[model samples]
Target: MPPTAHHPAAPPRLDLTDTLVLFDWNGTLVADTDRALRATNAVLTHRGLPGLTAEDFPAKWKLPLAAFLRDLGAADPEAAEQYWNRALAAEPAPLRRGTARMLDTLRACGARLGVVSAAGAAAVADDIRNTGLDDRFDVVLAGVAAKTSALLSQRPTRPRAYYVGDTEYDIHCARAAGYLAIAVTGGYRPAHALAAVRPDAVVDHLDQLPGVVTALHAKTPAPLGGTPA
Candidate 1:
């Protein structure tokens, strides 16, 4: 005889009440760096310029797409931008591993969640719908030109706030907006790149976030910076 089916493991044990967590969309929640690289290559090849390889792309990748294009010697940055966006939408990327589970845990623990991204609204919306995470975020701010100002606008109605992302720029935005920065590895940037920014904490995976939050709350009500875990 087979055992009767029961629900999965224990209920979420972390108490994230009165906490707000914001996440960066592309590399943070969605595994889309490969898509970005492809787009970059498309632009470069079209312009008869040298393309970047996976090994060197991360170090060269920067925010403010316009500036990156300009730096790449794009003659018509606007046309290049259109081509890049089209390439990204051609095949949207999948969500990072444990993304849904982490969101569920955070919501179960009474945390408010949102996404702030530089990705275009159309792409972000398609991603949220395709990934079935449309209802996961309380607020979705996309196509943001200035992240620091954007991060500052989302005031938390809670006692503690955290920003989870994969880039040094994200750390800067989080800290500037007075949120505890939580960097996750295996995104757009490398671990060492994120580490040099001195984020409040760094986790190797998304599933580890709940534990980090628990420890931070239990040990230090106000989080100080931490080493990678």
Candidate 2:
């Protein structure tokens, strides 16, 4: 068996000061969540597999594709893979709000940015690259089996961290990976669901985001050996 890698211990308190901010692409930063879910469900229905419904999507949304599909009763790996491939091929639109300004705020504040999503790397790369938001993050990770694992892989470059996302998966990932989690109410799962994971904070809109980060991660530059990064 492959050796398991261990993650470092988590901080006792959730703090965002001078920390790197990681985001989940689909529901957090981009609007592709609905599009992808819809497409995937379409594939599931067409293949005679049970379709993934929005009401039930979040429950299994965190699982990696292979396992998620298998657990959902996609009898063959080939069929499951094909469904996802077709859905990705649709080339959907991105999250409509805060795509530009929010990123600018983070960068201007000197906060480093990264992404971790269950979405496949190739597809996420293409979306980011093509949409031009790819340049917004210093690091972008895809095909992450779990968001926690993805966050750990970049520990060398990221500072004390916080993750911004829209589902329980994101919150769970942040907690498991030793980072502060902040849930956004713009997507599939309800804010309450995300709160169930006990995220450090939660936001109802994107405009209020900067303040949330500010309040949590006050280690702003002048004191942290760097300026507000």
Report every candidate's CA lDDT.
0.80, 0.68
Highest TM-score model number:
1
- Look at candidate 1 and tell me the lDDT of residue 201: 80
**TM-score, cand. 2 vs. native:** 0.78
TM-score versus the correct structure, for each prediction: 0.87, 0.78
Task: Evaluate model 1: give its lDDT.
Answer: 0.80
Stretches off by above 4 angstroms in model 2 are: 1-17, 52-60, 77-82, 219-229
Residue-pair clashes per candidate: 0, 10
| lDDT, candidate 2, 73-191, per-residue tens | 77775567656856775676665486667676767766688888777777778778777885788888877766778876665454567788887767777777767777887675765
Q: Model 1: clashing residue pairs?
A: none
Candidate 1 stretches greater than 4 Å from native: 1-13, 222-229
